[model samples]
Target: MTRADAPPRPENAAAWPRLAVVALGLLCLTEAAKLVAFHQAGPMPRASDAGAYWLLGAQVARGDVWMAERPVAYRTPGYPWFLGAVQAVCGHWAWCTAIAVQYAAVWVTTVLTGWWTWRVSARPWLAVLAVLVCVLSAARASHASLLLTETWFTLGLTVCGFLLSRPGALTQSRSTVAIAAAWCLTWLTRPIGAALLPAWLAIWWRDSGVGSGGTRWRAWPPLVLTGVVLAVGLGPWVVRNAVLFGRPSLTVFLGRELWVTTFGPGRPTAGGLPSTPEAEEIIRRASPDGEFTDWGGNWSVSNRLTASGLSDAEADALMARVARQGIAADPLRAGLRFVVRGIDYWRATYLRSLTDYDDLAGTASDVRDGQREWGNRACHRFRRAWLDAAPERNLLVVELSAALALMGLAGLWLAPSRRETALLVTALIAGIALSTAALEYPSYRYRMVLEPALIVCGVSGWPVLIDVIRRGSRTL
Candidate 1:
């Protein structure tokens, strides 16, 4: 829909064609790779996390409604339930069609990302270059074909970033409403969207001045509406958790993860106690804490839970005791570890070839038939050989990375305004940091979500870099 008071179109509208052609070419290449993989794998319903997501879809397809269940409730219902709805219409055929639908969605997101770059920079060539870099990136292409939640989660986030990237979008009431709806939808799509909370609050605080009467009162309606919409989408899950699990929890899996990650076997406990296997052996030999804080926390939590496990109060007491012990001994050290772990998570390798990410394919492939399972030295050799098999295809990644990094630096230097530069810088830093913190799976997949934005900055920065080089040569 056209905005009634939208600014006049610039004379450079004709130049968008070249941008589209370039973007299209990149998309064609990306999609071609995905198509080949899909054809070979028959849609990857057997991938690691695919079982849970596919089952959710199956349940939805069969009209079996689920409420909050541990592990399951941790996932926001947008994607699996979405696939389930698709299955309802398409029946068993939807299983095969799911990956195709994801590809289509990703393609649309790529196009929109390009358009957003063009809108912000008003540079058609830069926009196309950004799209090209995103498509060609190895990290991005790896995850694009998977039957994972990252695809949809990334899409919703990208759209939200695109919308909020411009102040003008928020100035128009209708546009603001639309963007807010998308923002809420994004939160509904993934728990990571919680990070956007600070950004939203910042926007509301800043824009309170623009509302009617300059009293900030008019802003309340939209703010409240946004909250309500998000609640309507997410409240049912919380309610179900409360009723079914006897826990008024925001997420289903955090407590168990906390117990496991913080104090399990081979872990450093809250009291600065080193939990070697001996501790586990001791725990097994002794009465132990029965609390969920030590020894095989992951397996125990999932396996030991009955129709009704420990109550919320019991869980809290267990956590508190462990945390107190942990804090008393090495508070500073523990804090540092947590911080480092968070950084490690944020910077974890998420971008890599699909073969690299898949345990089943790597182990089962003919290339790995002779590989030693104990040391995996043979598997490594096979992987290297297989990866090198497509020597020419590797050039795409090298060029893409170099181009994007260069363009990103250039964009920061050449950004037309401080605000624009800050947006790019903040997003690049935050996206990478957040993604790294949330996942330990080191494949370029984590980077894919930020590819378009990174590309835009990189492309935007190019001219500035060239100018500097030319100026330096002249000085010499």
Candidate 2:
């Protein structure tokens, strides 16, 4: 098609996405007000997780990652290092600058989400919706004001996924380096990011690789480059763990979390694990020994660990052992709960933690802990919390989340494909979500890394599903 003979291009082809980004930036700009408020929270325990992160980041700055002779296994060094760096630049309102940078990363992530959708689905509306969905993410906004890994991890995964989905990426040296860098940043920030490596490699071999044997050999260089990047970026953390805890891994936090979620007498709830008498009885029926983990709840875990005098790594390993025993004791119940958690993973809406946004850490204990009885109409506004007064927005996000999940499922299975790239993306997202479910209770916060894939797949597949149903009815 010659230029004159081609169809006319649409005017302002990218206006919707650009406008949405502008709106999102405006919303993030509002978070600056809380910077002075966050600066007021003293260095002590409170409801808000910000306190822990704040203290840890200071420790990182002082070159002391150990507190009370226990290694800081639950939190990674990336965010703390980031926080320490930001604190140096802006002493009091460090969170202000940090959120500004994070929000900027989010802005770029949303744009990339749209671009990736268009690349795979070739539909402009879907692309716009993808960007809008990410922009409106309450999880992103909530974590924006706090010191957390969600934003950085989300950006890393999106960038990594987008690079992997790019046409013929593995064949180019520069793209390979970029892909490796993206993955390293992601994995260092949150160790779970490591799981995506196998997924990406599989996608390349099966879908993204060039067709010819001569070109297939080109993949080796990129693979080696990926290995090199991981070694250089992750090697220090591994060495630290090996020396301090005798574990050559990134973190030991997973031990306590899995032990509680897997063995605790908590019901299979959508938003999170909740303690209930009925749940307790179900555990008693599953395996009487399960009651052992339920005695003091999380308090019991800490008590036992303190009494046992186990090193952090040793305690972590012991808890992991008990978790495995719980699974083996009643594999049926464990598997059922796993599927439920996976369902929660897909349907979980973003929780804003409105109180946290206000920086009222000391006052909003009830809302943050989800243990208090609010009015009859308590809205679960944040992760794992059951009351927050933001029910309307929360419900809307849930509906959007479910719609996207269903649509993505359909798209992954039935949509037309560009060498099955959509399928690869679906598998990648689902893998991350399910892996997280296995490790922690159902929380919408983890879904930040997943929103883009859901939007892309859901948008692509919905039309095909509707057409299929329509055609089947006609035949009938």
Candidate 3:
């Protein structure tokens, strides 16, 4: 008898994780090429907060944390400390090193985006798509090249999501401490990141069983412990502010932020009134030529105010009062602006803004041209837009954004595993955006922290989209 038909050999199909790693590598390389082209395209200034952060980093490198001879309360010590260390060692290559380190952070965030998508949605393909979206976003990927808090803040939020999104992650003692530290550092990096606190506490309260059969009241210990740890970590800075400013402070920049909404770029939104002679006098005194938008420029006004017989607290207080007066004078207009500002925060797409906003267009198109040569688009929408052409919107971005918004809404009910995570992520994003919207003018630069979480939620409702497509094909 012929024994020709033997049992078939077991297959050696590659694990999705290994495939994901390979995909991540390819994407990182692609992003690296785009960064190189961008770098090769003339110099990009360390404008706005970038310049201030650079200056603070320089001070840190010199082992002096003070700025303009006063204690550095305008900014927390996180990014400065981080940038200073890179600057101290890399020296001439500090820029490259800073970008490299931040790229690593972007890499981890991308991985987290995919990982959370896979775990929460239980869809590996969705996870891969999320990773692609995270990497392909021009603004999300480009911030790595700039010296800003976006990189570290995104990393911190992703890390916290990693720890907090799991079923019983908070149940572990180590995880609780780790999340506290991660979030604390993130808050230090950008104080706005502290907005996650309420969300975290809600998550903690939701699942603080302590053990398999413990009472809810007994869960209080761990929650209290976590809060105390974070508070203790922040104690020193608060004490410093208390001593220097006659009261404890988290940073004296809030009034300036509020002032900007009322008088700076947000003036039109506030009431569109021309500056008063009295306000102009102060503005000129602060900035001789009146450059109020720049981070350094605005801070100079405060410093000068402090030098001219007012304390740091007094300077900020004055700005706050000015901002308040503007809002009070036109409460209806100001309130409308506040709502629009918050809406704008989520509506902004960095891809279009990259090639249209301010001085960015000329430089961005040069990089876009470079990207064209290699068939590597930083943002695929910029196919033929020139460096000096009139500003135009990318219809593709507008269309996709609209479609995704619809899909995302449908995805809410489809994703059973995502309720807690979605709530947590949404609260963090909305909290940060709305708080800033109420106090300051809108800018997409600050939206970098919202990217990873957006991807996670955005990829959620694909099942419904897939079902619709399948039904249509069957009908056809």
**Evaluated with lDDT, which candidate comes out highest?**
3
**Candidate lDDT (C-alpha), each:** 0.54, 0.61, 0.64
In candidate 3, stretches whose alpha carbon ends up further than 4 angstroms from where it belongs are 1-43, 65-70, 209-214, 266-269, 272-307, 349-410, 464-476
Model 1 agreement with the true structure over 120-212: per-residue lDDT tens digits: 667777677667655544345344445577777677767776776666444456766776778666766666666666555555545666533
Highest TM-score, which number?
3
Candidate 1: regions farther than 4 A off: 1-41, 45-48, 68-72, 210-215, 259-329, 342-347, 350-421, 424-447, 462-476
**CA RMSD of each candidate after superposition:** 8.7, 8.1, 7.7
Residue lDDT tens for model 3, 340-390: 777666555445444233333233322221111112244322322332321
Q: Which ten residues in a row have the lowest lDDT in candidate 3?
A: 366-375
Cα lDDT tens digits, model 2, 49-130, are: 6666666666655656443233566666777778767766676555455656776666676677777877776666667666
Candidate 3 lDDT (Cα, whole model)?
Answer: 0.64
* TM per candidate: 0.70, 0.74, 0.76
Rank all candidate structures by their lDDT, best first, as comma-separated numbers: 3, 2, 1
| Residue 172 shift from truth in candidate 2, angstroms | 1.0
